[model samples]
Target: MTATTIPTKTIYAGTGRRKASIARVRLIPGSGKLTINGLPGESYLQYSPNYIRITYGPLHTLGLDKEYDILVNAQGGGLTGQADAIRLGVARALCNVNPEHRGALKAEGHLTRDSRVKERRKYGLRKARKAPQFSKR
Candidate 1:
């Protein structure tokens, strides 16, 4: 009788938020590839180089850009917010893979969550801060 065993790859998870967007990211061992909400990352991001670069910033900073496949579930907000969220998520996931990477990621600002969001409109204002035109009679 012969016995065989299968190798299993570990999956690392992290969550990130920016503005109103939230992203859940997973890191799996493989050639570099990114998928968001079941769609190819490039197509989902509208093929924008800036967005692509933003999402991969952490990996590049650590020189691990081609070490893993990234799967993300992102929702809410615009593309920019989602991209930032993904960047943070990836950085956090890398930290899980190896905590030593934290300092590098933090230094690169990839671990910071942007706190800016839309301001609420005041009851007497036309917009968030716009006031009615002055009437000099």
Candidate 2:
């Protein structure tokens, strides 16, 4: 008996992060290449390993068999934060692909947003939490 296979619905999503000033981005399967917000001559190869690892999470964990075009737009973060944020976004997109994976992705904490960010400084302080030097003798 010949068995028939069912087709899975493809889902498209976007993610972004801010680190210092640079933004990180990630997109789903595309035409054998990655695109980033229309910045010509830009390649995914230029990004760090973390960015690569997270952006390609669905490919590695869920398998790269998928073939779809994803566009990413990110800004206002350093490469590290951007990379992490991108991972968060991709993980989210994957969940969209198949809601069943939510448990696994959530267990891994990939779906959670990073709350750490730069804190604004207050008056009479050198930094956000730091205060002026005080000496009493």
- Per-residue CA lDDT of model 1 for 15-121, tens digit only, reads 88999999999988889999999999999999999999999999999999899999999999999999999999999899988989999999989999899998999
User: What is every candidate's alpha-carbon RMSD to the true fold?
Assistant: 5.6, 7.0
Where is model 1 more than 4 Å wrong at Cα?
A: 1-7
- Pairs that collide in candidate 2 are 18-76, 18-77, 19-77, 19-78, 20-78
Where's the lowest-lDDT run of ten residues in candidate 1? Answer: 1-10
What local distance difference test score does each model get? Answer: 0.92, 0.57
Residue pairs that clash (backbone atoms under 3 angstroms), model 1: none
Q: Could you tell me which 10 consecutive residues in candidate 2 have the lowest summed lDDT?
A: 1-10
lDDT, candidate 2, 1-137, per-residue tens: 11122355334564545444333333444552445556421354365565666655654665543564445566655556656666676666666666887787777777777776789999899999998889897
Off by over 4 Å in 2: 1-11, 16-32, 39-47, 65-69
